[model samples]
Target: MSNKIAILLATYNGEYHLREQLQSILYQTHSDWHLFIRDDGSTDGTLDIIKDYASRIANITIVDNAGEYTGSAAGNFFKLLHFSDYEGFDYISLSDQDDVWAPNKLQAALAYLSLDRAGGYSSNLISYDNAMMRTSYIDKSQAQKNFDYFFQGGSAGCTYVFTREACLLIQRKTVNITTYKGRSHDWLIYAICRANDIPWVLDRQAYIFYRQHANNVWGAKSAFSGLVSKFKILRSGWYRDNVIWVAENSGADVKGVEVFERVKRNKLVDKFYLLTIVSQLRRSKRECNLLVLILLFLF
Candidate 1:
């Protein structure tokens, strides 16, 4: 039997591009899939559009939200995963309400996962700005460094596909969590798999058209703008907080850096000590240098 995939789609006020994204999913080459959608208190026509699709499609399911608003895309996705019968599915994929998936996206992901014997899969994306009519390839498939998952996600969550075993591990890790600590879901998932020694494949192929818009929670930015944004986030101490949270919660046997414990205390000496091992923290040299600067000044 062909692999049956459960696609978890999270939506907010995404009425504008929701139809196009839904249409793209309907045209996928891999047809053995079920779509489970959950809305995070959308006050717009997003719910109506989802209802229309569910009305016509037998395999599409609208997960009941119980009138509780998650208030964030990551939270809504976590709720979707918690409520969906994912254990019954052979594989699981995540979807955003505004991205257009390639026709062969699922088929290609499944092929890579099977061939590599991997537990999780993610790929690069083609980020498109509709208003500007500009497109750029976003490459997130850099070589994995020692603790890269602790710093960033492998790729966009919309491009993520996980084996049943991977899903089980995620569910177990997040079972007792009441709050997500403002961390991206994709980062947490990648961290979980990596911490458990699960082989995760990062495909160089682009499988989704990641939409960039004014309301995007984490949209693409220009190089300079991205640097400025990172600076602002670092200045606010959010990065340090998240790193400590992941270290504590990700189940990794936090080794090597004996100063990790002191760094968690926000000590100045330990922060300086971390600057020496920045290469192990991030994947790219540019990012590693930036991380060192952040530790030296911002931390």
Candidate 2:
């Protein structure tokens, strides 16, 4: 028997580009795949499109949310993770309703996903504007070490595929309420994988056309804009709060917990204290974004 793949898709008010994305999935080269989608109280025509597709495809399953809204995409995705038919698949994937997947997306992800260990596979994505015109490719390779996963914003959930062990690790460790509320679903997964020493395979190939629009909950921004945003977040202290939340809820190792405890102390009263904290956490010595390095000082 062939291995089964479960593609988890979460949507809310995504009627505009939902059909195009669904069509792209139909063109995938991988044939042994099932789509499990949950509509989080979409008041638009999103359900109609989903119904149309489900009526035609036997492998597609419309997961019931009991008409309750999940508030955010991250929450909806987490709900999907909790409600998924765990024993029915070999591997799991995340998908956004607006992105158009390449024909080889699943094939490439499966190639890199190793079943022997708890690990994840993610790839770069070719970003597209609202008009569906290509803009630039988003590189998710900056995460060179476990520490990098916390310091930098990396891949979106839509680009990830995880083995059963990896998925189980996340499912078993996360405190569904606080974990999903404080961090994005993908970030939670990355942190949990790192905590347990699971390898993350980040491919450089762009496997999907990631759509960016005004309604995007977290859209791509320029480097300068990202820096400004980070600075603002640090100033407000939400970054520090979120980091601590993730570290505690994702079951990070002793050292991981120790470093974050230093952040929780909020002892950055001087340059000396800042240097001490950065030196303690920068164990990997891996190259990271300069802005991220600066933000580390803030915590």
Candidate 3:
């Protein structure tokens, strides 16, 4: 089997953090990898930094994201995602422009993907914490406290990796869609894994020291705001997609919209979630004000 990987990066004006992020990938425990980058019309020196890396690094390839064919940022992201189908790679990592990965990041995630399950390699998600981060738009308490438990969500875009099965599904679905001002990709993928019953892992260690700079699309919100935004993210593109709408999904496809209507008609998880929210709200009120605010902040 080919132990090859393509690190697909989606970039736009990421000059400042790009170098550090790239360096982290280079410092991986396993080096049999190719770095593929696409620039989304960056006026900043982001493209220059990529050029510098490509010049020095033999495996790296830089492509211009003309922002012409794809109508939006999500489309831009998908453009890079179609790497393996066109380029022929065994695995692809959805690399963010900002986070600093731990040296073992690739090793751990790729190792998991390479494992033999049953007969063939099944798609799995390995998400780790971006331990160190500073955010402007995201509510600090809500965003910061994510994943106290291991692999809480599917995986953050900052350090998400995909196996061939998942990549092929993504291509078939054409999932590079922007919703909620492009803050929707992470949740959408989570819903995808959930609906398809895809197995995933939430790695406890901090694989990437995620930096929460101002340019991040959206993150860090009070639990209420976070959930609301996520719901919107799910609902916007979610209203028309045909994917099954399980508890975790936003119901974007036709079936998804149907699921939402059915849920609304029958009152399913909505009441259950509302009840949980109410209980939590009561519990928070009994706790200290600061603590309650933090809990709410992370909601």
Clashing pairs in 1: none
Predicted candidate 1 versus true structure: per-residue lDDT over 1-299, tens digit per residue: 35899999999999999999999999999999999999989989999999999999999999999998878888898898888557568999999999999999999999999999899999999999978788999888878887787677889999999988788878888888787636788988888898888999999999899999888888797678877987788889988777666656667536423644756766777776677677877877887887787777887
- After superposition, the stretches of candidate 3 with alpha carbons farther than 4 Å from their true spots are 67-73, 83-88, 114-153, 175-183, 221-259, 262-299
How many residue pairs clash in model 1? 0
**Global Cα lDDT for candidate 2:** 0.74
Once all C-alphas are superposed, what RMSD does model 1 give against the true structure? 1.8
Choose 2 or 3, whichever is better by TM-score: 2
* Cα lDDT over the full model 3: 0.54
lDDT of 2 by residue, 1-299 (tens): 25578899999999999999998888889888999999999989999999999999998999999876768888899888888547867888899999999998998778766442436877888887856454997777543554655544347889988876677777777534643544577777877777678787777788898888878877675568766876787778776677676777666635465556555675644334545445333323433234336555654
Cand. 2 TM to true fold: 0.87
Instruction: Go through the candidates in order and give the clash count of each.
Output: 0, 0, 19
Candidate 2 ranges with C-alpha deviation above 4 Å: 115-118, 130-134, 175-182, 222-231, 253-255, 269-293, 296-298
TM-score per candidate: 0.94, 0.87, 0.65
Tell me which of candidates 1 and 2 scores higher on TM-score.
1
| TM match of model 1 to true structure | 0.94
Better of 1 and 3 by lDDT: 1
lDDT of each: 0.85, 0.74, 0.54
Off by over 4 Å in 1: 253-262
The best-first sequence of candidates by TM-score reads 1, 2, 3
